[model samples]
Target: MEMTDLRLVVATGALAAVAAAGAVAVWRRRPRPGVPLRAGAVLLAELLLVTAVALVVNRAEGFYPTWAALAQDGTTAHRPPATPGRLDATIRRLAADPDLPIAVPWRPPSLAASPGGGATVAVPAGYLRHPSWRYPAVLVLSSPADGWTDARMLTAARQDAPTAVVVAVRAAPDLDPGVLATGMPLDLQRDLRVTGHRWGLVASDHVRRSARDVAGRDPGRFPAPVIAAGPGPSGLATGLRAVAGQLPAPLAAPAPVLAPSAAAHQVGRHRPPAHGPVSGIGLRHGP
Candidate 1:
C-alpha cells in the first residue's frame, strides 16, 4: 500500500483500537495467564498506534513522497524527472489524456535564484472540459514567509475564476525580476496554454516592490499588478475586477471565453501539456 494512503492510516488506527480494547477486557477478566495476555495486547496496541500516527503524519505533510524519497533524505519528488530533451514530448503525451489538471514541480535553471526554488502552475477548474480553450493566466507573488500552500493556491485559483490559471511562487529579496518576467512564461508556455504574451499579477503587500519591478521589466507583458494587503486587496485594479481573495475578472464581455484576445495566437504555436502532469505528481485536492 502507498505510505500516504489515508485508508491505511484509518485501518491501522482501527486495529490499534481493537488491540487496546482487548487489553482492557483482559485486565477486567483477570483470566488465566492474565499478565502475559494483557502485556502482549498492550504492546501490540502501542506498535499499531505508533504506525498509525506515522502514516497520518506522512500523508498530511508528504515527508516521504515515495519509497525512494524515504530511502534518501526526501530530496526526490514523488515522480521522476523527464528525460533531458523529452520534457516537451512527455508533456504533450500526458496532455492528450483526460485529466482534471497538472501542478508539476517547475524548477528551471533560469529562475534558480527565486525563492522556493520555483513555482507550480495551478491549472484552472474544469480544465479538461474546455479542451479547445486557453486560460487567462495570473502570477501570484507572495513573500517568502507567506506560507502559500498548494491547497491555498488551488482555493485562490477557484476563487479567481474557474477559467484563470494561477502560478503561485514566493518572491525573494535578491530574485531577478527580469528573469522572472522572461523565463517563467517561456518554461510554462512549453506546458501550458498561456497563449497571450502578457499575464496578470497578484502580489501581497510584502512583495509589492518586487511585483512592481517584475511588472516594470516588461510593461506589455506584466501590466499593472494588483497589490493586495493581507486578505483584502487595494490597488490599481478597481471595482468588480479587484475582488478580494480572487484574481481580477478577465473579461467584461457576457461570454466566458477567458482568453478571447489570446485565442488568435496558438499558445506560442505549441500544444498544451497533459493536465495530469508527468508520472511523478498526482493531483491532490489539498496540499
Candidate 2:
C-alpha cells in the first residue's frame, strides 16, 4: 500500500481501538457500577473532541480537496495588464469552487522619498477606470514583508468588481514614533489603533505613529485612500483605540469613499516595484 494509505489506515485503526476500549470499559463497569464508567466516558469525550479538532485543523490547512486554499505569505504577482484578466479568471474559479467571492490584486503605486523627508507616491499603472483597465484600485499601508502574491490578492479582491486593483504601501521602521513624532499625531495614532488584528510579528504604535507623522506632513506625496494593517500586541492595542474612536482619516481616502469621477482616470502605465515595504518587516493588508 502507498505510504499515505498506510498512514490513514494506522490513524483509523488507532481511533477504532480507542473507541472500542471506551465501549468495553463502559460495558464492563455499568453492572459493577464504579468510577470506571466515568473514566470511560471521559475518555470517549476526549476522543470525540480530538477528532473534531483534527478535522477543523485539517480543513484550515487545505485538506478539503473541494474547498481548499492555502493562505499565502507574500508571493510574486503577475505583471500588470495581464494580471487583471488572469485575476478575473482565478476569482471566478474560486467563487464557483468555494461558493464564495474573491478579492483580486490591484496595481499598486510606486514609493519615493518625499520632499519633507517622508515619502513620495507615483502611480505606475494608469487610471484603473480608463477603458484600458476597468477595475478600481485600493491603497494599502502595511509592511513589505507581507508582499503580494497572485493567489492571495485574487482571493481577497472585492466580489462586485473582480478586477479592482490593490495597492499595498509599506512603511519604514525608522519612521516609528521614536524617530518621527515628538508627540503622537492623530494619523499616527490611528495606525497604532488597528495593530491588534495582525496574525504574526507586529510593530509598535510608536513606530507607526512616527512613520505616519512623517508621511502626513507631505500627504500629497503618498497615494490616496490608505488602509493600515498591523500585527502583534502593540497593534492590537492600536486596533482597540481605532475602534473606540475614529482617527483622522489618513492623507488619502480609501477607494470605497472615492467619487465616481475620482475613480475614473486616463489610461497610463506603471512601472513594477512601485512600492517597497520597510526593510525586514511583514505587515498585514487592510480590508
Candidate 3:
C-alpha cells in the first residue's frame, strides 16, 4: 500500500480501538437502557468522530490522494519538457484516444517564477492537426480547498463549452509541512482559502503569464482574446483580472460570473465596458 494509505489505515485503526474502549467504559459505568440501543448510539458517535478526525487529518497532511496523484505527476521531474515535436506527438496520440482529454501541465519558461509552480492546460479537439488555427483561451482560477486538476476542468468544460483552451491554476502555494499533525478543524482550512493568505493578485498574474506563454509557444494554435474564469473564491480572482484588464489582445468581453452581490459590487465599482475583453459566460454557479 502507498504510504498515505498505510498511514490512513493505521490512524483509522487506532481511532476505532479508542472508540471501542470508550464505548465499553460507558456501558460499564451505566448499564441502563437496552444493550443494543446503547451500542448503536455508541457506534454512531464513533462513526461521526472518526469522520471528523479523518477530514482534519486529510486537510492537515494535504493527503488528498486523488488530488496528489494528478498534481504531483505534472511536476518537471515526471512530465516531459514541452517542445513543438513532443507536444504535437502527444496531442496526436491523445486525439486518437477518444477517452483522453487534451489537458496537460503547462511549464513554459515564463512560469519559472510562479508561486505554485505551473498551471494545467486543456486543449480543444483538433489542436494537434490544425497548426494554422488559433482559438480563444480561458484561465480558470481554482479554490485552494479543492485545488486545480486537469480532469476536473476538462469535465466541466466538456459539459459547458469545449471550444476554448482552458487553463486551471493553483491559487495557493504548499501548506507548511509542520501543520499536518495539528488538531485544528477543517473549517479553519476553508477559511484559510481566503483570509489567512490571500492569493488573488498572485493568481491573476499567473493567469496572465500562462496565457502569454501559451500564445508565445504556439501563436497559431492558441491566440489572443483570452478569457479569465473561476468559481467561488477563484471567481473573485477572475473578477480582479477582468477589472484590471490583464488579458492579452482581443480581450474577452463578458464579465466573470460572480456571486450576485459580488458581481453587482464589482460592476458598480469597476464599471467594466459593455464590450470589454474578458469573457465570463460559463461561470454562472459555483464549481
Candidate 4:
C-alpha cells in the first residue's frame, strides 16, 4: 500500500482501539448516567487526535495526495519517443545544417530508464556555425505536474549573453505511479506534490552522463562546469545537487525564482562554491 493509505489504515485501527477502550472504561463505571456522554467525548477526542497525528506524519513523509491527480493529468502530454541512436543522429543533422536558424525546435533525447522517463535539451544559438565553440551546459529540473519542453529552455536562454546549452529534466519519475492509476478525486489530489521515489542521486548521474554524451557527439560543442537550475520542487533538487558538490558551477537564479528554502540554503552554504567560468545568464523563471 502507498504511504498515505498505510497511514490512513493505521489511523483507523487506532481510532477503533480508542473507541473500544472508552467503551470498556464506561462499562467499568457501572451504570453512572453520565458515563455514556463522557465515553463518547473521550472517543471523539481520541479519533481527532489520531487523525491529526496521521496528517502530520503524512506531511512529514512528503506524501501529498492532492497534487497527484494534477501531476497525472500532465504526465502523458506530448512525449515523443526517443528511439535508440536518434539523439546522435539529430545532433549530427543539426551540426550539418549550419544555415538552419537557432530558433528552430530540436528534438529532445530519450533518457534510458530515467526517473522522469526523458529529458529536453536546448542547444545554444549559432551552435551549427560555431563548430569549435565550447559552451557551458545548464540542467533545469521541471515540476512533476507541468513538464518543460526544449522550446521553453531556448526561450529562457539569453540572446546577448554567452550562449549555453540548457537541459530540462522532467520530474515524472519522482511522482508516484500508483496514485495516478487510481484516478483519485480532484479534491483529494489537490494538496501538494509529493516525492515518490528518491531520484536525486540517480538523476544527477543521468545529467552528467547526458552532458558527457552531448559533448562527445559534437566534439567541442559542450564543456564542463554545468549549471543546475529549476523552480519550485525542481529548484529544491537543484540546490541539493549544488550543495552535494554535484554541480561544479555556482548556483544562480533570479530573486523571484523559487529557490531552495532557508534550511536548504544553509546546507549549501557550507559546501565549497562550484569552480569554473560562471555563465552570464543564470536561472530564468517564466511560463
Tell how far residue 186 is off in model 4, in angstroms: 41
Instruction: Rank by lDDT, highest first.
Output: 1, 3, 4, 2
Write the residue-wise lDDT of candidate 1 on 1-287 in tens digits.
44554457789999989988887777778345557777887898889989888887665444443344466544533322221122334444555443444454567554565556777666654454444444557777776466566666665555443456667777777776655664455455535544444567877778888788777654555655777755433221221134322322222121211121242343344433444222222222221
Q: To one decimal, what is the Cα RMSD in angstroms of model 3 from the true structure?
A: 18.5
Best by TM-score: 1
lDDT of 3 by residue, 113-198 (tens): 44655556666554554443223345454445544446656665554434445556564443221111111111122211111111
Candidate 1's displacement at residue 240, Å, is: 11
How many residue pairs clash (N, CA or C atoms closer than 3 angstroms) in each of the candidate models, in the order given?
4, 28, 3, 4
Clashes of 2: 28
The TM-score ranking, best first, is 1, 3, 4, 2
Tens digit of per-residue lDDT, candidate 4, span 4-87 = 444455676677677767666775676664855876867776776676676555433333433332254565422212111223
* Segments of candidate 3 deviating more than 4 angstroms: 1-86, 94-100, 146-148, 173-287
Worst 10 residues of 3 by lDDT: 191-200
On lDDT, the candidate that comes out on top is 1
Better of 2 and 4 by TM-score: 4
TM-score of 3: 0.32
List the candidates' TM-scores in order: 0.48, 0.23, 0.32, 0.29
